[model samples]
Target: MKLNTVENLVRPVFPFTAIIGQEEMKLALILNVIDPSIGGVMIMGDRGTGKSTTIRAIADLLPEIEVVADDPFNSHPYNTDLMSEEVKESFNSQITLSQKKIKVPMVDLPLGATEDRLCGTIDIEKALKNGIKTFEPGLLAKANRGILYVDEVNLLDDHLVDLLLDAAASGWNTVEREGISIRHPARFVLVGSGNPEEGELRPQLLDRFGMHAEIRTVKDPDLRVKIVEERSAFDQNPLDYVESYRSTQDNLKERILAAQNILSDVHIDYDLKIKISEVCSQLDVDGLRGDIVTNRAAKALAAYKNEDSVTIEHIETVITLCLRHRLRKDPLESMNSGDKVDKVFQKVFQ
Candidate 1:
């Protein structure tokens, strides 16, 4: 089966393993896959920094999910709550489950997408032609248990941003139209990338992301040349380049799956938890989100490292990602938000 549903013309993506630099962005994406409740990732950076490419490449590495056959929402057969009332009734009489080795869906939410298209719509054709009320699943449905990637996310309309934030928070999408209402599971890892120069995301929407990563061009001449060389080789022969990195990608995938399996069992240290809370308070972060996301991110990092318990090191690894986007901008401070996070981290954890 295809990894992700092909909603548009397809293109060969740069291999995730082959991409050089931007390790933080990659880690944030992987952690979300391991435990999606960590919230989605927001990658803010300059153009040509592989932000979009990294999001696309992740689709190739994710494992397939077991879902109900032909389910529009990719609903798991065993999760009755995720199913619609009609579907549950039908399942009472008969139940069928299928394993689809699909690409972890990486759905693009275009700037032009309307509410009707992003959220499911009433089936006008069925209503007019057959006198039946039906629901036409939309992009959110396709993104269930997957990634909803928005390029230039800062440029998205305020209303659309609000809609996405609501769905991200509630893990459900309910569409009401003409006396017909449809509800379905819309849980997804919301991956958004944008050049900060284009615009700033709404503060409310920005806070919804679980982790934030900043990407920039490689500065070192040697690394820059290597990045160019790798790109040239991939362009010269996409298939061959992908094959060369296949083993590394497979290994990483295995690690991610293992991490997911043990994520719940990974213990959070009480002292570390206190440190996390104290750090958030010191940073003057808006709400408890920083503490919550920091805890979750550290747990994910521990899981990624196959550690049974979270450590100050694990918390340090993720504190920046969890709090960078939530910090209030200080005009008098010369340091950027990320830099501020680093300074605070040094003081709090040192």
Candidate 2:
């Protein structure tokens, strides 16, 4: 089967609207989509609270991206790779083909993945036979310009985490070994999830994430029953369940596209910007990335609400989602990050 057909079959196509309540987590993911440069979000909480579900649902909400046909990396036609002599000849000679509306790539990085598997390795047989270095791209290469999800990310090997952070920061990956040097685009929105009890992510790795959300199992009896019932019904008839919510999902897809266009025109008043910066400053976030992400998220919130301008309410709503994970650790303090953010919001936004 062709790759696109295979993707549609294996990729779990979940409707964004079908997900149960987890508003903050959902909104943060949407904002990252609006502006991928905002970096990726880390969803930390207890297991079975739908962290994976939320990440999977995001695929349905995104519009299909156009890519070069048969390129393992989904290299854009305008990419630097096209500047190479071989690729340039192919393009100039009209030997390249264009792809259609394929599903957005959302690849999972499993815990036990090997370094060679995560990053491309030299194709030994091909290199030996042809006497030329040939590269085999891996997960990071395949995940270009899309979501790279790492479940149980805190448990990932230290070297793997370092590789991820380096690629994320540079937006490109370079490999130099055994008479081969190749660099390709590796930009992606990094989404990670883990239970804190398993193991805590290192501070360096933690700081790379732009936003963090905590998802707890719903405690309310009524909500819990509804969640169980929905899952049961869906499993009994997956296609019918998916078909029923198809329109709702389509509507959300349109909204995301509209929000992307509107985001450029969405203005933030000076007062609101100052308030957001002040909240981050008061929290003593380690870098300016915190303030920048906070402002971007607040603007996204305003756009999501169809507001022409950002308001103090938007700032208040986004403050916690932006600063919670970036705060200094205080093991002796009993207060959670959310509580600390709430206290600050109440004081500043009021």
Candidate 3:
């Protein structure tokens, strides 16, 4: 289908605010939106828990970004390296910049996606026809300055997982194919969802996510009913359902933008930093990732709530999300990661 036709046929997404329950999943996604530098979020949960719904809603609600027009990677106007050589030449020839609202690209990495599809490939058509070694941007390029979402992430091939990890960590995609080398900024928020019953995620891959949130089916009858009703309404008339929640969605978008505006000014005092370290030390988290992620998540929460500084409350709210997957797993222990985090959190903060 034509792009516009496909987009037109696509039903409007259910608004973010309309999602019921799963507060941790919501918070983790919001935090990542507020600060992509917070790494990314890993959501492990049961099927039909709105994991995919919430992700699409988030993409729909994100504010638009400006880019150099016709740039395959959605390269920032000022970021020369991300632009094609033609765009660079146009810059010297007085290229006109344009702006348009876009639903932040949320590219899904499928289980069977090939390396070339993910990292892009050499333009064989151009090479064979015109003897030009042009490059074709791939999923990684398309995901630049947006979100890379992987469902059933634990089941992903090891090589693909490693590729994702490298992109997430380095914020760049460099593809050298058939002697044609290309590089571009591939900064994106990596979000993944999977069911643990399928299999455990690799520790290295698990550690890459800055925050981890586990969700379960809604147990409360009232909330479950509400969720069911909402889904039914959405399925009946997606456009009307989205319209009904537009105001709430706008409020959320405004709040996210406001938080981002004030995030740099939000402060974390030395004592709290020490406390964060103490908590990490007690938890036996490897390296300094947990501490750094914890600090970032705490500050992001404070910023999201329009606070000027990080506090114990902020730390408490974000500790579990940041440290959950970082803990060493024990085959003999059955305690939930959240419970372990809460225990350490209370002990350290108190």
Candidate 4:
């Protein structure tokens, strides 16, 4: 389908605020949105707990982005495009044109997908007709500067998972096939969801995710009924329902934008930094990514609170969401990182 047409047809259904519960999951996703450099988030949960719904809701919350027109990869205008001399000159000349903002691209990588489809392959017909190798961009290319969501990620083919991990870690995709060599920016926020009961993700891949969250099916009768009613009302008239929540969504967008502006100036004090490092040290997280994400998340919380700097309270609030999944998992023992975070905060901040 045409990109613009898809934008209109598949309007994001749930506003971020409209989601019922799963606060940690929601906050982790939002933190990623605030700082895509934090890597991505993996939502592991039981089925039918709004995992996919929360993803869709996040898509809705995101404000539109502007990019170069007619660039298949949605290449940023300021970025250098490594193409043939002729194509590069044309692109350089075209850079003077005005920019526009459209919805951020959100592409789904399906299970059972072939390597060729995920990473693109040579266009055989074009090669035969033109006597030149033509490269077809894949899902990763399409998801540039946006989100690449994988449902049932644990079940994904090992090779495909490896390809994703490589691209995500490097922020680039190099396609050398059929005697053609090409490289392009393929940076994107990777979101994956799967039921833990089904299987476990490879530890290497799991560690690549900046944060992890879980959700459970609501058992309360009234809350369940509320969820059903809200969904029913939304389905009955989606446009009207979206309209009703437009203000809420706009508010969230404003907050995100404000946070982006405020994030740079928000300081992580020395004492808070030491406290955060101590907490992560206590949890025995693997690497500095935990400390980095913890610091960033604390700053984001401060931005959200309109604080001038990250305080001990901000560190206390974000430590769990940032470091929970970074802890080593032991099948024999239950590890509630939340309780650990609470204990650390009580000891440090109190």
Candidate 5:
């Protein structure tokens, strides 16, 4: 289940491009990868819709990045913002730090995880006995600059959700004990998936996710059969099935890398920004997060398409996914949230 912990173990990861249907889910993941600062994605759908499989595939699709060798936090070799304090000290000392390339870390947060496990614990006993502060790095430490996924996120405790939101927003994890403190970079793309049939996530918590993608069982008979056959083929011979899609996967990876490089330079028109806010205002979104995430997601979509400017098409494509979950829910109303968002968008943008 851990990508970084087991090196000797070899397992076949299904190629991202080989997956069938779930266009919205795949697009949300790709947009986040192209721009991790879009917060993270909230995927709500039917059970067994390839949520976990798609997540793993996306991680495997990415190319390796350079990190300071043997660092628990996966500290970047030269990026101070991504470097741990310890690595920063070494960097400041002009030490020649060794580096290695590794696939992006994919950390799965189990529902049973405790606070101490998610956030590293300060070793008070070691501090008292040896007069040296010791810290046991936790899941957050290992997930730095990677993807942190929480399955069945609706079932996770609210306090734990709060901690995750805080760390995700701040891009850092701080552990304090007995007046001693330890902090490090915990920046990552936070992906959470759950079944809507089970229960809906709290609106406040759901709002924190930058974009929300809802998927359903593929109803097209031929497409469903294709998906089944593909899964069967992959299960029968994972390596060969994965290899068949190597060219498509490489193209996807190259697009992601290129989009990331040009994201900062991507621009959005001032009139479009005003229209985005107008849509949010008309929808009665609680806060400005919808407007901001919409702007960011629009820019990301434009970048993903290799365009340097955000247009109405980019906004139209991403606005529903970004704002649907942010709207106030009516217990008595049966209308779909996405439909409501689209209606508001079309009205305002027109």
Candidate 6:
């Protein structure tokens, strides 16, 4: 029998392994993939630092996830928690749901998007007339179990930001209109990037992000030349350029998948956890989010590094990313907060 297939447009996304520098930003993105509960990453960097390119590359690098076929929510076939209400009901009724492996979604929320567009609207007229509930899913529904990227997120409308904060915080998007209600999973990695020159997100929205990664333009002349040459080559012949790095991409993809599989087995020491909290306390970070995200990010890094247990090295690398945005100070300032985190991490760990 001939195998059925669906061909998606194969954009020549730059290979994640081929991305030069921005190691902090790259690592933050990878950790979120390994554990989305690290919440998500707020990537602020200078223009032309490959911030958007890196995000897209990582999205392309992610492994395909098993999902219910024809499900708009990208519902997990067996995980009722991850499934849409309709899918769950069908599953509970003993329906044999069709399944397919799909690339994890990558949703780019346009700045001009309206509330109804971001959060699906209920078809009240149809529901009342036909006596059948009709709901139209939106970007949040489509982003379920994937990556929701909002470029220039600092400039997003306050109302939209409120909607995103709610969805990201609760992992669910609810739409109610005219007494018609619909809710669906909105659990996805919320990645936002903006140049500090543009503006900054409010502390509340900034703190909503689990980690903060700051990237800078490569300063080394040789490295700058290399990045330029690589981009030139990609633009010249995207397909061939991408193919040259296929092996490296496959290896990195395998590593990420393996890390995810072993993530649950990774453990952190109680003393180390205490030190993480101490570092947060010293930083004067508000609430327990900083401490919790630090611990989770540290564990994720250890797992990504193929270590069974967390270490100071892991904590040192991830602490800054986890807590920098949570500081009560201005979020648009130069990334010296990362240095402060390092300082406190050193003092606390000692």
By TM-score, the best candidate is: 5
Instruction: Give the range of the ten consecutive residues with the poorest summed lDDT in model 3.
Output: 78-87
- Clashing residue pairs in candidate 4, if any? none
Arranged by lDDT with the best first, the candidates are: 5, 6, 3, 1, 2, 4
Tens digits of per-residue lDDT, candidate 6, 206-324, equal 99899999888788999999999999999998879989998989988988988998999999989998888888888889899898898889888888889999998888888888887
Per-model RMSD to reference: 3.3, 3.3, 2.8, 3.7, 2.8, 2.7
lDDT of every model, 2 decimals: 0.86, 0.81, 0.88, 0.79, 0.93, 0.90
Q: For candidate 1, lDDT tens digit of each residue in 109-218?
A: 99899998999888867777898878888999999888899888898888998888789879999998666677888889999889989988988789999999988888
- Find the 10 residues in a row with the least total lDDT in model 4: 79-88
Task: Please give, for residues 251-350, the per-residue lDDT of candidate 3 as tens digits.
Answer: 9999999999999999999999999999889989899999999999999999999999998999999999999899998988899888998998898888
As for lDDT, the candidate ahead, 4 or 6, is 6
* Tens-place lDDT digits, model 2, residues 1-350: 45667545663455779888999899889988877767788889888998898898896678888677677776666555423334455677877557544567888998999988888888767777898778888898888878899999998998998898788767777776766677777878889899999988887678788888888889999999999998888788777888999898888888888888898899998877787778778888787888898888888878777787888888778778878888889989899988998898788888
Candidate 4 vs candidate 6: which has greater TM-score? 6
Best by lDDT: 5
lDDT of 3: 0.88
Model 5 ranges off by over 4 Å:
1-9
Q: How many backbone clashes does candidate 2 have?
A: 0
Clashing pairs in 6: none
The regions of model 3 sitting more than 4 angstroms off are 1-8, 79-94, 124-131
Candidate 3 residue pairs in backbone clash:
none
TM-score of each: 0.92, 0.89, 0.93, 0.88, 0.97, 0.95
Clashes of each: 2, 0, 0, 0, 0, 0
What C-alpha lDDT, on a 0 to 100 scale, does residue 334 get in candidate 3? 91
Model 3, C-alpha of 283: deviation from truth (Å): 0.9
lDDT, model 5, position 316: 92
